[model samples]
Target: MNTQQRTSTLQHSGVNEAEVSKLFRNTYSLLAMTLTFSALVAFGSMTFNLPHPGIIIMLVGFYGLLFLTTKLRNSPWGLVSTFAFTGFLGYTLGPILNMYLSLPNGGSLVTMALGMTALVFFSLSAYAILTRKDFSFLSGFIMAGFVVLLCAVVASFFIEISGLQMAISAGFVLFSSAVILYQTSSIIHGGEDNYIMATITLFVSIYNLFLSLLHLLGIFGGDD
Candidate 1:
């Protein structure tokens, strides 16, 4: 190519990079906001004694919102959907918070959740930056795992076996960890231009991973 053409190409590439970087920044900012909102919703729901129907509605709404976000990840609509999903997740998390609060060592559960969340986010973020590997290849595997996980969750309603619960929690922790790795790598490698969606995916994984780890720890560790 001529010198002028080369310069134009470089300019275009630079713009794209800047856009991607902006997207990443926006996504993380939104993620932080959503986490805060979710925490507030959970706390409020527990405090107000919200009905089971409200929780169910929130859960269903969260799934719908997530579906919408994933479908429109390339557009502004995706960002809106992501915020909606986060709100719904927060509302749905109320019952879990309520249950944990009822436990003798509820404060410990919160500490564990916070610690696990930090560990997962920092470790996965570091790995993404240092390795700079594209994890989009794992998309299919993660989808399959999610399917199996859904089925297992449904089955648990009937089984109610402690061993099965433990096993499922273990699988969730692993699966969520993989999601964190994949989502983070996608951001670093420029595979994902929508950081809001990316952040939402990573946040969900971190949240689930922390929950699973907390459950496992509670099961194995004695209440002090």
Candidate 2:
């Protein structure tokens, strides 16, 4: 939104052009840094062939750190918590990536998945920013989809459902993409005022998007 329009809406939304611009800068910068840190941790973990922590540990660590980060978001410690969360997540992924790498044409699949993720995230995010369209309408759908996705994930452990993993991956690809659009649009339109939270949200979407792509590619491209 332009300055004049922001000024007109200031009483209602308290969002100005300068605030939005600052949020965009801070969020993106922190996101880039956190991503780089996660990559480094992933690379190191993979190099050492770290053991998989299993789903339970992974879930606990992820949610624990996420909650901690959210609580400390206004403090300097928030940055530390963000790295801890992202780094732990990347470490957890190393074992999965190694499993994929052990498959036929695994390297190619990983490369392809990463490429696709970057393409999808950047393109959708750019579209949201340039268009500056309000995407708050997607909130309800995204939230509902997230709950269903979580349930499916939990149920897969007990139920021997065929192709359930692939289905979940596909759902995540769509869900994560919508989240990126919604998050970017929210930032541009000044719905999210906190850059720390914005960074975490977008970071999570990117991370999940990449993992989902990796799973889908591995399912379709890996050798039998």
Candidate 3:
């Protein structure tokens, strides 16, 4: 390449790197804030002994807020929608946590689940970021996995089968972990440039992973 061409190529590379870095930083920062806000809301719900909203209300609220977030992703209102989504999920979680906390050794089980979720998320994300491997190949698998899981969840409402529930939990753990890796790789590889959307994806994955771990722990960790 000629000298001028080489310099131009170098400048383009630098700009690309800077943009990626900024996207990564903004995504993580927003994620941290949303997580903290969710936690506080959850604590408040638990402290006040809030009733668990029924499945209908919870689903409506979650999907509605999520839709709003998607529509507003490019605008400042996206932040509000994001928090609304996370906080609603957190509120739902508070009652679930209360149920578990009523069981024997429930406190320890919850703690263990939380620790495992954090460990899995950070480890997978770090591996993806440091290696910058293209996990795009897993995209199809991840989507298929979610579809199967969604079917399982729907069936669970009717079947009342313990084994099926366990399977669903295990599936979530694997798929959610894959999502963390895939989503982080997407961010660094320029597939995902919107920090708001990225935060939503990562936060949902973490939330699902934690719930799955908690369910598995409750089943195996001597709830009775």
Candidate 4:
């Protein structure tokens, strides 16, 4: 209403905008770095023909590093933990990639999956940023979806159900896309103030998206 009040409000709004912008920049910068590092590690693992590390080892290593990252999210140690977690995932991925590469048309399958994952991520992220839509409501859906997906995954291991595995892969593709949008929205809307956490969120979404797409492609496109 009054000039003084209007001016103060404008200044506060500008400050908030600047803070969000900075957070977004920092998050992507860290994400890019981590992705590159992880890729390098994966490449090394593949070149050296590293073992899969087994399911038990993978789970323990992943959860252990993830916990450390969360606990140290506000500190510099968080960056170390984040890289360690991602690198571990990448190392696990190497053996899987090697297996796919052994199949006929495997390279093409891998390429297609990688390309599609990138396309989906960038497109969803752009949509979120351009529209500035609040996707916070998807929070509950994402949580529930992951819980169900996890259960289905565990069941598939014991049941040997092809349909269930396909369903889980499809679900992951959709949910991972949703996560990309939701995380981007959170950064721009000021819901996520920590770049370290934001980077981790986006990176994991990308990882899941890539692997899910790979699984689906391997099923449909790989030669028997």
Q: What's the count of clashing pairs in each model shown?
A: 0, 0, 0, 0
Tens digit of lDDT per residue, candidate 4, span 1-224?
A: 69999999999999999999999899999999999999999999999999999989988998898889999999999998999998998999899999999998999999999999999999999999999999999999999998999899899878986478779989999999889988999998888999998998999999999998999998888443
Better of 1 and 2 by lDDT: 2
Compared with the true structure, all predictions reach lDDT values of 0.79, 0.90, 0.94, 0.91
1-224: candidate 2 lDDT, tens digit per residue: 69888777775465477788889999999999999999988988899999989888988998999999999999999999999998998898888888888887889999999999999989998888888899999999899999999999999989978899999999999999999999999988878988889999998999999999998888777442
Off by over 4 Å in 1: 1-13, 51-59, 70-80, 222-224
Better of 2 and 3 by lDDT: 3
Q: After superposition, how far is residue 61 of candidate 2 from its true place, in Å?
A: 0.6
| Candidate 3 local distance difference test against the native | 0.94
Q: Kindly provide the TM-score of model 3 when superposed on the true structure, using C-alpha atoms.
A: 0.97
Q: Which candidate should be chosen as best, given lDDT against the real structure? A: 3
TM-score-based ranking, best first?
3, 4, 2, 1
> lDDT tens digits, residues 169-217, model 3?
9999999999998899999888899999999999999999999999999
Best-first order by lDDT: 3, 4, 2, 1
What TM-score would candidate 4 get against the native? 0.97
Question: Please, what is the TM-score per model?
Answer: 0.84, 0.92, 0.97, 0.97
**Candidate achieving higher lDDT, 1 or 3:** 3
